[model samples]
Target chain A: MRILVLNPNSNPEFSAQMDKAVEPLRFGGAVRIDCISLTGTPLGIETQRDIDAVLDPVCDAIAAKEAEYDAFVVACFADTGVASAREVTSKPVLGICEGGLSAALNAGERFGVISTSNEARNAELRLIRSHALMERCAGMEPVNIPVVEMMHSNELAERMVSAGRRLAAQGAEVVVLGCAGMTRHQALLQDELGIPVLDPVVSTAAMALGAIAGRG
Target chain B: MRILVLNPNSNPEFSAQMDKAVEPLRFGGAVRIDCISLTGTPLGIETQRDIDAVLDPVCDAIAAKEAEYDAFVVACFADTGVASAREVTSKPVLGICEGGLSAALNAGERFGVISTSNEARNAELRLIRSHALMERCAGMEPVNIPVVEMMHSNELAERMVSAGRRLAAQGAEVVVLGCAGMTRHQALLQDELGIPVLDPVVSTAAMALGAIAGRG
Candidate 1:
């Protein structure tokens, strides 16, 4: 089976990070997973306009290659265009926010989201409300780091741990790493927080595998 | 893609009902879904011993045909042997209870489960606790009807709605049909109760599709 993970922004570094993060889920030779960056979008999708800026092209890309792959995962924490993508194809399409949030709920009682920015936190909260899972959420804690800085920063782990501690203090039993770019920090943050930490890319990829498995 | 939903019991009539319940989920020619009753088990599994009695045979069937199908869905509300099956095969294996509960958490907060028997309620609650989601659950309400009776009884819809109301009074915001055999009544109960009602079989099958989609 072949699955495509689409990074909505046009940043190769972010795409590379997402690709590497999902490596643990490849499940040997039975499934092949690939991640690609969308061209002509913003470097980082921090606002609604940034998400709106690329919905059309991403939808077009999925439509263009709908038959080539068995499934698709949109690598965005806000779940941008996920409903639209599902409408365009019968194939299963999932967004990172849905996947991560669902996995967090399954992992514990109340989950808190750790995001790259306050802007992303609003987007994440809005997405959670749309899914009706906000009642089970503790709240969102921003790491105050930009998406690009997270890619190469030495303090990324500290920021995530600090935010995770605050969310835990706020009654978050489980933590969801709200940025797909923070996929590499999942294990480290979980260890630091002493609670379950979910990575959107890994969780979505796992869900995609399950969705693909259901097809069988 | 070929998917097998195993009823894990020896009742052909119950298997037939389960088969019919999933018809709406079959998306044209993209996937083929078949429901079959397993021999050597009870007509209905109402106890932990019954689940134990069928685990080996069910695992054997999965392992025997492991190469033939893409994934498996255990059609019991008890989610019999799902973990063991995953340990035995690399393919995706889902318990209806897990799928339905996860989907419920995604759909709303404070979900309730409606089951066919008091015994089934115990099993359902145990499974919820095992998933660390007991806090999110309002409680379990039994219809007081046996699984086989639900298949032929005209009162099934009314029973589900009554149970749903009781659950609602208990603070359940969403309802999950706790039996895979109750799949046909999901839409009716949802409309009558004015809350989202989840059919375990349908949710598991849709989840299976997502799991399968992830495989690529």
Candidate 2:
């Protein structure tokens, strides 16, 4: 089976990180995962306008690749264009935010999220509400980093640890990294926080594999 | 890593089925799964009294095997004593109901559950409410079959398909088998319903594997 991990933003760095995040799941060779970035879009999906601009392009990408891939994953915390993409294909289409939250639910009763910025946190809150998981969400804290700068930010890990600690203090048993750009820090943050820190890319890939496995 | 899937009920047949349900996941050899049944409990966990009676034994079993297992899975659909078991070990402990619901959330916006009886349905509803997922739950429909008889019933698949159809009509995008004894019917039901049908045992096993992988 083949799965497409599409980063809605134009940043190739974020797409590369997402590919690395899901590398471990590819060892069994049952599924092939391809992570790609949507060209000609915003470098970072930080604003509502950025999210809106990518919706049609994301849907077009899914429709164009529907015949080649068994499943599709929208590698954005805001889950940009996931609903519309679903209307274009009968195959499974997953969003990183939904995938991360689902993984958190399995790890704990209450989960917290570490987002890239205040705007991203608000978007994630709306997504959580849509999933009817507002109660199980302990809280969302932002590191105040921009998505484009996440791969280069020296204090990103420290800020993430700080946000994670605060969430844990609020009784969060699990923490979800709300941005795909933060994919590379999952193991480190999980080690420092002593709680499960989910990488949305990895969680969604696992879920997609489960979806494919169920078909047989 | 080693994982113990403890079926709180005393039925050996059910325990064997649970073992079979998770067999496909053993291919990678990264984790070992062992399914065991408590020796002196009731044949099947039905009423509230049965749920209550297995609490201590489940906790004791976890405590006794804590050093040997990397994680613990409470395989009963009621999740007989998961919270209490957590107090006995620092290892990750999962309940099939929570795992199944978490998987369902990944599969769709709204999910329906197929239960064994009215009592089991009520128990599952309580579990869903505890997880703050009542809003995402479309409904629970019971087939009225006792847990012990689920495997022997020739009409089990037909009843499950009927229940799934009703749930789909109610706008449920996914279906979850609320009983571990119903594990064998997952793929068949999914084919018949044309939607994802989750086996709680399989779902919980996948989560346990994820938890183990995250530790690295």
Candidate 3:
């Protein structure tokens, strides 16, 4: 399957990281993937309107490339434009929120989502319910750091690992790093937390591939 | 106030109904509501493993009491534990998946649902998705049917005013609703056929009440 993943932001660095995270599934030569950074959107995560702003154009891009791909994956953890994109595409549009929630919820009866800020709380809650999974939340603790801010913070990796550890202490059998910027460190957190650390971008890509290719 | 939504699948009549339908928020006094249902488990929506099957004992029969009544909701649309009640519980659990989803998602956007089965087809994918929503569905349809044979079918309700009609014609704003029962009306077909309904039982309850109670 040929898949198009829209990052919905202007950050090429973060988009590159998302690409690396899902590269494993492509190794079997069963799927082809593209990681596109939205050309005119904001650089960091903010509000749904910010999401909607980028989403409108992203939908345009998906439509433009409709013939080339078997499916599309919206790589943003918030899963912006997911429904709209799916509306326009004949192919399946998988969102990171759906993929991450489905994977994390199935792994454990309860899970904790570590947020980048208090502002993202609604998005987090929305993602949970949209998937019929508000019941699975153990709890969510905000780190009070934005995605870009996390990248540049001192002791960044340590702080993130601390959040993961705390959620595990809260009985979170799995920890979902809520930002796409956290994708590169999924393995690091999973090892330290001693549980699965789901990177939505990577998981959505893998899930889209799997859904389009069939269960086998 | 801390609230709990208990899903009772010991017998699915109510539990199965609560899985994805929408319920309305009635009597908005000083009440905290929690809504949930047992769908993904075995027992035909009952004995779910690796989930909250154990919470049943802890849930108690809070549904009958009037004083514990700052307010309570059963969380299950089936109202499985509604009979032979006890305690002074004044509130409601608000488990009507179809009712709540209809009231909640219907208010804001076009909502539709995808089902896990095909048996409920030719049923009302749009009607249920629209109960709370005047017209929330973008598209809806079913996928696969699970193994359980259903008994009380009338509680399922017939399709009245199709919220799906608008969703399909206008390109649904949101899409959801997937469960063992809704399996009969899986979403993929609706979307494939052009109907969008979001069937998020837990999230809809949380948001609708949170919006009303002004609490998370």
DockQ of each: 0.11, 0.47, 0.03
Docking class of 1: incorrect
lDDT of 3 at B54: 29
Residue A209 shift from truth in candidate 2, angstroms: 2.2
Q: Candidate 3 on A88-175: residue-level lDDT in tens?
A: 8756677777666554542344678878777887787877676555666777777777666655666657777888877887888767
What's the best-to-worst order under DockQ?
2, 1, 3
Residue B78 accuracy (lDDT) in model 1: 84
The candidate with the higher TM-score, 1 or 3, is: 1
Q: Ten-residue segment with the worst summed lDDT in candidate 2 chain A?
A: A22-31
Stretches off by above 4 angstroms in model 3 are A214-216, B1-216
lDDT of candidate 2 over A148-183, digit per residue (tens): 899889999899999999999999999988887776
**Per-residue lDDT of candidate 2, residues B71-177 (tens digit):** 89899888889988878887889888887888788778899999999888888888889988899899888889988788789988889889999999898899999
What lDDT would each prediction earn against the true structure?
0.76, 0.85, 0.53
Ranking by TM-score: 2, 1, 3
For every candidate, how close is chain A to the native chain A in TM-score? 0.95, 0.97, 0.92
Flag clash pairs in model 2.
none
